[model samples]
Target: MLKVAIVGYGGIAKGPHTSAWKKIENAKVVAACDIRPERLDLAKSAFSSNIGLYEDYKEMIDKEKPDIVDICTPNYLHSPIAVYALEKGAHVICEKPDAISVEDALKMQAAKEASGKVLMTIRNNRYSAGSQYLKHLVTSGQAGEIYSGRCGWIRKRGIPGKGGWFTTKAQSGGGPLIDLGVHMIDLAIYLMGNPKAVSVTGNTYSKFADNTEKADSSHATFGQAKEDGIYDVEDLAMGFVKFDNGSCLQIEFSWASNIKRETRFVQLRGTKKGLEFRDGIIDVFDGGRNTKRARIKHNVDARKLDTGIAKVLNGHEANIRHFVDVITKGVEPVFTIEQGVDMIKILSGIYESAQTGKEVLL
Candidate 1:
């Protein structure tokens, strides 16, 4: 069995990652490390008292020498921890955005290349039922030439961790563009045939920094909230990305906006048909019949898919399973270190564009 170690024992590590580890037959979490004593204790309880717990990730990695390292830490720590784990000769699976900056992402890529081990960041959205079906259509040429797309994850009132790291620029990068944009943006790019983004133009806003309204999104409870901590990041970000293939994507991400409701969606325009993925449902619209001038629509509901599992698995679990398969079964990885670097470049360009009020070349 592959011995696994987790770097952060927080909500994401404790919840989805933990559930995924349990479902994977060839791997087991033998250790967990966290800076918080309370969180370490919680990890111990969940993994059983026999599991190793440490305050420092380096010490945990050195002592345990685990085969796999799962990183679910804050955005800033992702690159460092992943590099350290990769250098230690362990395959790594990390949470999203890859890293906060291009330099840090390159560092992780170098480590992975040096170690010659798997380094897969979580792109959980691609594992969703709707996404898989859409990918099938795209690869099979049924979706035709996907040239343009729009994607976003907008929340009515869901600034996570309020004045904590989620709102802090230094720790969490540049807010919703990094936090929520990664999800839909990556999905859109993936479905659009993994196009290399060439340029980006963006704008950011931080109007909800001091607002005391209660969060309406369950996502708000992700991290520890502070009464009066730093809130230096943007609450909303809108951007446009142009790819080398001549395709383009329009994106919007907001943690707390005055929208009608919370929604996560991606719409891709293809030559044959247009795909609309909203709130886990996919709708394909064939523009019109040549003779009748009537439109045809096909709706695919992800919730109704027969996944052949004991229970419905979220994208995280499916992604984790894929990671294990890649390591143990020599399965080709859907996510790569180079792709991660490209993703970071796009995000960093958007942030730069937001600041300079000009298009940033990636």
Candidate 2:
């Protein structure tokens, strides 16, 4: 059996990670690490009473020597922890955004290469049935050469874990752009054949947290910032990225916006046909007339959706199952280190553009 340890006992770790691990036969989470004793207690309560818990991940890795490390920490902590785990002779499965910056992502990639260990990011959307179907259709030439696409995830009031790392730029990077947008952007770029980004122009806004007066408290999970907490990140971010293949993508995301409710969209135009994923449903249309349509439904638990993040569905179970395949069968993962680095590069450019008010050249 592949011995596994989970770093950070946060919500995702306790919810999705635990659920996913229970389904895998060859992998077992024997250890957990968290700075918060309360969270460690929660982890023990959810899993086994005999599971090992450590306040520091380094000590945990050094002592337990787990074969796999599941990193479910905040954005900024992802790279350093993952690189350390990889160097300790363990394959790593990291949560999304991979890392906060391109530099860190490259460093993690180099470490993974040096260690000869697998490093996979949890881009759960890729494992979703809708995404799988889209990939099959596009790869099979149903959607020919792509031109441009639009993707966005917006909400009226959905800031989660308010005063925590989620709202802090240093910890969580920007805001919805890095959090929710990363998934949509990844899906867009993936469907578009992972085109290389050449340039990006973007903008960001912070309207909700600053002025709770304008925020819809009715739907708000917006938390109070701790004395040391911060709300420096943007509430919304929008950008246009041009690819080396001459195609362009328009993307946007907002943790809290002026929209009616939560909304999501992804549309692509190709030579032969067009594809779209709107509000969790995938659709295909004839490119010429744009009239003929086919809708594909994914097996999503609609009634059990996480209201805090309604735009995107969680595919944690499927993502972990794929990781199991990679570890047990030595198969290639769906997303590569290069792609993970590329994601950071694009997101970094978008943030730079947002700050400098100039199109950033990738």
Could you say which candidate leads in TM-score? 1
Q: Can you give the lDDT of residue 302 in candidate 2? A: 32
Q: Which tens-of-lDDT digit does each residue in 150-171 have in candidate 2? A: 9998877777666678888898
- The TM-score, computed over Cα atoms with residue i paired to residue i, of candidate 2 is 0.90
- Estimate the Cα RMSD of every predicted model relative to the unseen true structure: 3.7, 4.8
Stretches > 4 Å off in candidate 1: 289-312
Global CA lDDT of candidate 1, please? 0.87
Which residue runs of candidate 2 sit more than 4 Å off their true CA positions? Answer: 213-228, 287-314
Tens-place lDDT digits, model 1, residues 87-115: 99999999997999999999999999999
lDDT of each: 0.87, 0.83
Question: How high is the lDDT of residue 71 in model 1?
Answer: 97
